[model samples]
Target chain A: MAAQTKPVLHGYFRSSCSWRVRIAFALKGIEFEQVPVNLIKDGGQQLTEQYKALNPMQQVPAVEIDGITLSQSLAVIQYIDETRPGPRLLPGDPKARAQVRMISDLIASGVQPLQNLYVLQKIGAEKLQWAQHFIDRGFQALEPILKQTSGKYCVGDEISMADICLVPQVYNAERFKVDLRQYPTIKRLNKTLLEIEAFKVSHPSQQPDTPADLRA
Target chain B: MAAQTKPVLHGYFRSSCSWRVRIAFALKGIEFEQVPVNLIKDGGQQLTEQYKALNPMQQVPAVEIDGITLSQSLAVIQYIDETRPGPRLLPGDPKARAQVRMISDLIASGVQPLQNLYVLQKIGAEKLQWAQHFIDRGFQALEPILKQTSGKYCVGDEISMADICLVPQVYNAERFKVDLRQYPTIKRLNKTLLEIEAFKVSHPSQQPDTPADLRA
Candidate 1:
């Protein structure tokens, strides 16, 4: 709660939601500590009572900041943007801001949740196929949207929260073997976004908890 | 686009996402026209090319307002709250706003998407079981958070976006047969919320396209 206390991000190395928060922090130049709650270790540490106390949803990337803990990456990102001085994660124009939220929600809700660890685990042996199916379907819808919305980034020339959402989801898409060529706008935007310092530092491979073998 | 032109909402009667937008409109005292994009009739009208153009995501509750169209119910709701003069759907304080968004995203992304029509159709014969599993999981997590956050609604006494999201999802939970008694906070909030005119007018059973048998 003290102003001098650094924010602590409790997250997993490869979780897309965690990566989103990392990108927001890096973009905002807000120094934060990492406390990895490995999703796969010891039958998922996130499910433990300790972590659940931090986030009743028991999800990764529960951030302790501004005197309270916040989960849901978008909420944390918006909080950072609201309280900190940096590039605006949401654009000034109401229409543009709405577009950004629309795109972010499409990926966050419509796409990512279907292929996430818990859902895929419940999907059993058909996990790969299941992930592939949903990712492909999502990207098919997303392609045209990005085509309509993108200008150097997911919204416009400025890097907004939509761009923050884009890179991680495209990473998940590739991991699931979703063909990127099918979504030219998304692929181009992801490529452009990855070149930024904020995105590079926050990437899954570069995280503090990223396994050595997977390090950039 | 004109100032005098009424906002038009393209949505299905029973879709939970659509219902969220409806509640927001009702709460704002904004009179809007409904252009029903029936999700089930004629093989999912939302999949049609015309609707896809309105919302590249091919989802419901795309609102045509202020010379632009917005998809994703939360995005539309936020835009309305920002542009209109009425009861604020999002509280003004930063932390409280983030909490509202967190709760909204928890349901919108984490729970509802898993058991939505498209997902359920893909889930085949196990759809009922799958819906129950995710709803139960989501409600279990939501209960404690609501207990922590709720005063008279999902956030505080104000009818924020989290409350807009809560009613529709609880309706879906009942349809899927999740036991309400287990989630006392959610049940209590939903009960109190349902008594409000905003929620009553926006109920699925009272929608313009609600089938006669299902009408309130």
Candidate 2:
């Protein structure tokens, strides 16, 4: 679990999705080398021939383990939990696992996609507007789910995949200047997660590759 | 689980999302009343206050189960799978479950959100054009995963959540004039799933609530 022997994480410094996986690795005390892929610089280093070999989608946070490169942030992190020894990210039960996944999909699919750089770039100057629009809509749907599922973290006291999904989403939403005021359950749970160093240390602003202007 | 004692399902005749759940419920042989909610009438009957009370999001396929209503198409379906005793909708181990979920999320979150009615309305006439655009994007992402995961069904020989998710999305994509030649796996899988009566019976064209123009 020491820092030096960590597996390599090929990711963008400011990618919230990457941050989510980083947080999970941190929480599990799994050592990982942070290999930066600057998404915006030079029109995305992720799209280079070498990186594309790692991810066909040319997406970030693709991890290399046992010489096998895995894509998709959630899938990669779940693979880590499944293969590695540490605290389990997903719960043991089917229903609880479903709950963890529902939250993960909510953030990963619902909230995160709407604000992703590609999506933002697609919509043009209306990026900020679309970002807020989807964030609130996503959080609105997520708020009640959080209330029903959360205790201390996203689903009871012990951290699971749900918290891994939550913190990065809140971070991205704030980056887009979305008003998180409407979702109290989200706000409360996020505040609790913030207290954990695992969450803070994995934040995009704290990443070594983050640009000076974007640093928190 | 006779028809009379079963729960009620409020959905449109042609909403592929509803059709997917209907097929699931039918395969489980859990009877239910199909109360159609017209999506195009008066700007969507789902917007009505009574419907909103049943589902805050005011979307269809809301199930009134044991007097407690539930929303979100996937959540509703998962609840059914958990409570019912019939054939399981999702097959395989936790890893398989995650795979099925990833595929479902790829479509449900990744594809459906982009081609939503509200999204179409927001963007106007160019909407239909982008519908195929997003569907193609989704199917492209899905083909490889399904190819890797398939054994006859999405995760194996038995039909799982991946099948449920796939049927609807493919249905919509075909309806939008998207060519499925490149998505051979999805096309082959859809052809196989069609052999089952559960899926056949739930086709949007057969629904009482389906709009005449949209029906196949």
Candidate 3:
């Protein structure tokens, strides 16, 4: 067996993207240390020059592994799935893999960023309304696709990257007051997912940096 | 040799996501039939009941190939790269592949959706400013990473998916009036990318459906 290395993840408590990396680590059973970079404090610590140097994107959930730091939640997860001994986060067949990626990208690109903190801040007074609109648009598409793609998980009973992307985006949706009642498939899947050790332990409320009052 | 299937690409002339697929198809030497989905006509053709059934996301650049219709530009590109005999779009090494994905997702998730047509419309009076801000923010991160990751392309000398993503986004940045001079690496890479046949041919102005006045 290769030497075990504990990766260091630079992230915050409430960031959906950072929350994604946490779940992947838990699901894979890769023990790692978490360093909180409070996004809200000091006008967003992620926007600071030091954090920006660490991650040019200045985004939470940058992972330090094998002496290299990688940003982008999906990329960080992919690296962990690839280099570590973990449950495969992607599948074998070409088409199945594409389906997994399609679902993941739908949430990662199609939904999440549009309703993210930065974009929400720009929306000002109508932030909630804007978040709901984009979330609804995304979930409407995702529900039907998830119906076709999901079976106990986001992709056919196997916990894949799509599921990793799904849980946090669903958390964000609920935060913005988008009714998951409209997205039955997503709701069902999120319920099953939240029960899993990885998803449960990695929930924003359960994170190390989560405020005591916010802890559930 | 397998039977020649002229894959039909469902896209609009101006959709950056669609433009990404067009470049990938051209790069892979895939002969695809272009089906123009007029996003601006009839209150957006992509939102039609018929189109939504085809792609629940109602997004442009869904491709029909081998009797399967796939949506999401990155997913479609991955499908094409995987099943077809062509120059590879992602690298062989997992770390390298992760890097490519990081850059691609940066544009796909981090930048594009925030500045998408739907988001801009919702921004009302601040559309251009909003677009410029996100584009500039994304490009700032992208430029430095591209410097680390590029030789002739966004991820080494190979014209990977990152390059495919980069060109359309640079086009968007220019469209939004964001100064490319501020992102020297991106500007340089975009210049070189436009000179390539695949990217040049797939450009918005060169598309079959582009308005005569808009045509180059």
Which candidate leads in lDDT?
A: 1
Candidate 2's C-alpha runs over 4 A off are A1-9, A49-54, A63-101, A144-149, A156-158, A212-216, B1-5, B64-69, B212-216
Q: Judged by lDDT relative to the true structure, which candidate is superior, 1 or 3? A: 1
Clashing residue pairs in candidate 1 (N, C-alpha, C atoms within 3 angstroms):
none
Q: Please, what are the lDDT tens digits per residue for candidate 1 over residues A8-87? A: 99998899999999999999998999999999989999999999999877888799997888999999999999988888
lDDT of 1 at A99: 91
Worst 10 residues of 3 chain A by lDDT: A1-10
Error of 2 at B117 (Å): 1.0
Instruction: Sort candidate 1 into its docking category.
Output: high
Tens-digit lDDT track for model 2 on B153-206?
998888887899899888889878999998899999999998888888788877
Candidate 1 vs candidate 3: the TM-score winner is: 1
lDDT of each: 0.91, 0.78, 0.89
Q: What is the DockQ of candidate 3?
A: 0.82
Model 3 residue A211 CA deviation (Å) reads 0.7
When sorted by DockQ, best at the front, the candidate numbers are 1, 3, 2
Candidate 3 ranges beyond 4 A from true positions: A2-4
| DockQ for all models | 0.83, 0.25, 0.82
Question: How much lDDT does candidate 3 score?
Answer: 0.89
- Give me the overall lDDT of model 1: 0.91
Q: Give the per-residue lDDT digits (tens) of candidate 2, residues A1-216.
A: 443445789998778778878988998888788889989889889879888666555678777765555666776777778767888898876566666766776677557766788767877878888888888877877888778779998988779878988888888788788888888999999999988989888888788898899788
What is residue A113's positional error in candidate 2, in angstroms? 2.1
